[model samples]
Target: MRVTFGRHKHPRFETYTLHNGIDIDAPLDAPVNAVHDGTVAFADQFLGYGLMVILDHGGKNHTLYAHLAEARVQPGQHVSAGDVLGTVGASSVEGPGVYFELRSQGKPQDPLEWLAREGH
Candidate 1:
């Protein structure tokens, strides 16, 4: 499942380091949709991630979507892939863009593996 964004800029310029997942270059206000079916485990601001959403896919697997312009989901809410969870935006003064990640067993993991395995 390929995620889409609008002329999105990569977050490589930002100092905040991200763990894993696809980083789409979506301009501010672009709609950010879910990449997979899961439950919203976290939907709020963090020190670096800014406005973000974390979805739990069960079996200790989860995904983190960050640097959002707006968050539409909430903790404990269920969401499926392609579900619009928020809008991409400049969450930090550092710059504008998204920094996504994937995790397993409470640790960050390579999103490329999951994405490739799942044929995204």
Candidate 2:
């Protein structure tokens, strides 16, 4: 759970800040997959995140993928579990990896909890 959600001191900034996601250590351009069946909610560049994709998994649960090399799905597209959504990319600060997050009813949830539940 690298960079787990919540407040922590920034490595570069030297100040406490909220980190809203986990950074997975994947090589650049490695395929990134959807953890559950969902509809693509957003796929575009976001400040600080680089290229990003958000999946709406219903029940108000959404998953986020950031620092993507490319986004393969479009907004409103349906995706199944294991579907490739993009490839990992380098972020300005995080370097080569994928930043992931889960949210339920607009509140952040620990992705490690989800991953553990799924036996990933």
RMSD of each: 6.1, 1.8
**Position 76, candidate 2: lDDT:** 95
The pairs that clash in candidate 2 are: none
Highest lDDT among the candidates is held by which one? 2
| 26-67 per-residue lDDT for model 1 (tens digits) | 678888878799999999998867898999999998888888
- Give per-model TM-scores: 0.76, 0.90
Separately for all candidates shown, the number of backbone clashes (residues 3 or more apart, or on different chains) is 4, 0
Over the stretch 25-99, how does candidate 2's per-residue lDDT look in tens digits? 888889999999999999999998899999999999999999999999999999999999999898747578899
Which ranges in model 2 have alpha carbons more than 4 Å from their true place? Answer: 10-14
Q: How many steric overlaps does candidate 1 have?
A: 4
